[model samples]
Target: MSSPRRVTLSPTSSAASSAGFGAGSFVVGSLGGGSSFSIRSTLSARACLDCFSPSVSAMGAPPAPRQHQSEPATRQSVQSPPIATTAVFSALVERAQTQYAKSGDRYIGYRVLGDGPIDLLALNNGSNIWIDRDDEPHWAHFDRRLSSFTRLIRFDPSGVGLSDPLGAGELPTVELWTQDALAVLNAVESEHAALLGVSDGGPVAMLLSAMYPERISALVLMNSSARIARDDDYPCGIPQHLLDRFVNTVSDPTGGEDRVDDLALLAPSLAGDPEFQLWWKTAGERSAGPTTAKALDTLATAFDVRGILPLIRVPTLVMYRLDHPFLRPGHAHYLAEHVAGAKLVELPGRDHLAYVGETEPLLDEIEEFLTGTRGGSDTERVLATILFTDIVDSTKRASTAGDRLWREQLDNHDRMAARQLQRFGGRQVKSTGDGLLATFDGPARAIQCGLAMCDGARQLGMDVRVGIHTGEVERRGTDIAGIGVHIASRVQACAEPGEVWVSRTLTDLLAGSAVTFADRGDHTLKGVPGTWQLFKVEG
Candidate 1:
């Protein structure tokens, strides 16, 4: 007898928690008799319901689904550990779009997202362009939430992801890192912006704020210290010998298992997750080589920004996790005491990473501190542009091609769809037999994605019809529902094979945009109230 088919669904957000897989990584549902396909999320975490219905497995076996863990729901963000297939994980990384900034002979990589009033620049440790990919669902949500209130700017320093690497044995000083931040700010033409310094990035922020007081509006530090190494004055800092050992372990490429074990200490919340351990090792290796990582660590050990604390003239807020082993409570208190009029809020958690362990509380404090008001709770409904596609003559083609060939075609189609979805920033809702259902924050992106999907299908010897509509949709846990979804599916039915169709609502929204449409005349949609105007996308 063949083994039972298994479907694994992991939650990427609080919204996706209901379908189980709360702490799991990417979404992969591979069945036996039918076909297997991967799932994708949006720029932010929208509800992702596992939409696969396994009657028979794609591997020609019987269908059976199993959950990875029955643990209570833990809000898993991109900051959570990854428990996904390599293909799915790589697809997540492909979503990142890094822009370059010139800093003398070196080029710094940066990304600018959102258009909030205040420009908030993020100074993260070796995770500038890499972290922005939303590899973890909640990480994406965290960024989106920040963008909702502030114009968020994130960049990688020298010797980090997408940035110019340092020469052999060349270590970066805090001043050099400060210049890297300045170059990013100038690249975006940001005259003044708030700075968000996380972990080691705190010292850089403090240094920048102190030197360029006129250019910085405010400062916020999280799970970071003014001085990482212990001295006579600050006895609470990590001991030099212990710091050296920690740095060695983290920078040793061969000691991946040690890093994996230590990652649990860094993020105890994800300690038991096997997938997270795999992702941590993979991420470390990809972000930087062992030599560069060691050099960066050695530089961090010398980071002492306490002298500059009093020089910082901008409003400052210092926050730290109370129980973090490496970054003890004393560091936060010292920062608050030294930085003039700085407010210190002690957070309750052992997880050293800022995004893990009760992120909302940290976000709440940040929002209030920066925006002067705490925003409302996560919304259950949002405005979205829904896209629906259908494969023309799929059933007949499947029968003629046989199951093996048909499954291969389906897998190829799945990958093609994932690429397009990532390209256009569309979130995959679910698979509808031969086609797909997805949503985008903007109608133009949705339209472009639909066209791209249709073109890609043609290359695979298939014809796909697409329909798009923009309206408010109710978030029903991992699944989305409401009239908007129904209308989009219905609009897709109006399209001829290989044609892209859209409701008048979507076309109206896209007015003055680059996308052009031809009038298909007004027609009565099935199971709908009034007459609807539809349009076919012009090539």
Candidate 2:
């Protein structure tokens, strides 16, 4: 009897979770005439589906079946809007045309959304910019906001998205992707423009700014890191153990689920929303298949740009969520510290996916950084929700666990706390050793995260207390310091073990949420002028 034919997927990196054969090696078994080719037959049946798939659209048209040709560069004139209104903005992108930019032997996909005063080139993190257009509400909102003051240009890297695909097994490198970006700029006839790099695109933007300073007016990096692998000098990179798991997930057949999981981590605030999750899943499937995603993941893991930070000459802004699950604030801090004159703006949210959650704050910061104004205004004060959490009887727990074990537990606790904050779209302001202070755009999420943190602490054999307040806060550089902070801290102090307390302001704001609260009566808060009413969240 002959052995059965088995297909095996293997890892391509030494840091791969499983120990296996060398990279890029695929082993296949020969089949006899008597043997049935089920896999091939199945694929043949799906050929029709593949032929009409919307994902294969290139240059604004469905690709010809089994045909390969270079798309010529094209452009469309977009009227500069005094301010991008909803109706005008919707019409612009809907009517916008996809163009081709020649780079090397391949053509890259590019699009122009506006023709405002400044030219802006947006680099997506290893995804199709055309797919982003399908996310009309989010993408349109972003484009409209940006186009109000600048000409917004977006493009897909070669071999990804709507751009020309690479030859079989061909993977793009940072240098190649950067060249594609430059080609897009050339095709658009943009002499100079500001660059906005989100996530993986950060390194490409950095490289472009460093190599072609004259072509870049400024640079903005969002939820990105300089390096992705942990080392002796770079501790912020994902650990080998985590990287291995990530690689396996990316290569799995159900990697679409992994992508959704990633979206959850990157945009926890929107993960539970059906509309957002559907959009994310559809976008991911349309962006790339498992093999391509795995290849991109491998390339990103090896990406390191620490050496080039100092070489950048353009004015730079590094913005990150303090509680981002994938990239930590330290990564942004590192960029700001090394890049001369670079300003770091730590926004209040955990979503690494730019379009989800509280994106207005990020856009405000970016607009102000790039154009010296925010939404064409100068005001910085904005409405915000504050959350404060502290460990109950933490001093005694530390004494019981001892120094070494307690330190480990504390580290775990901090990680858990940050995840909870990220889940609720909260921005971690600072850690108070035994607790954390964070800010949010809405009070409902703050209350929900506080409840989750309490539950999580209980799972770790610990007790926690939480407090929430809603008020206006002043935005400072990478931090928020105002009376709101003091009120939140005092509110937390009133909470008992395993209890979540909130000010009347927060309760009022959470009017429609399922959350319920019991009146805690009025009390005087220290260092504050008036007496305040408080409430305890009820299950």
Error of 1 at 193 (Å): 1.6
Write one digit per residue (lDDT tens) for candidate 2, span 209-282.
Answer: 66555556667777777776667887666666556555555345542332224544455675566765565556
Q: Per-model C-alpha lDDT, please?
A: 0.62, 0.62
**Model 1 TM-score on a 0 to 1 scale:** 0.51
Best candidate, TM-score: 2
Error of 1 at 135 (Å): 1.5
Provide TM-scores for the models. Answer: 0.51, 0.52
- lDDT string, candidate 1, 286-369, tens digits: 666666666666666656656446556566777776666556667887887787667667666777666656676566656555
Relative to the unseen true structure, what is the Cα RMSD of model 1? Answer: 25.4
- Residue-level lDDT for 472 in candidate 2: 49
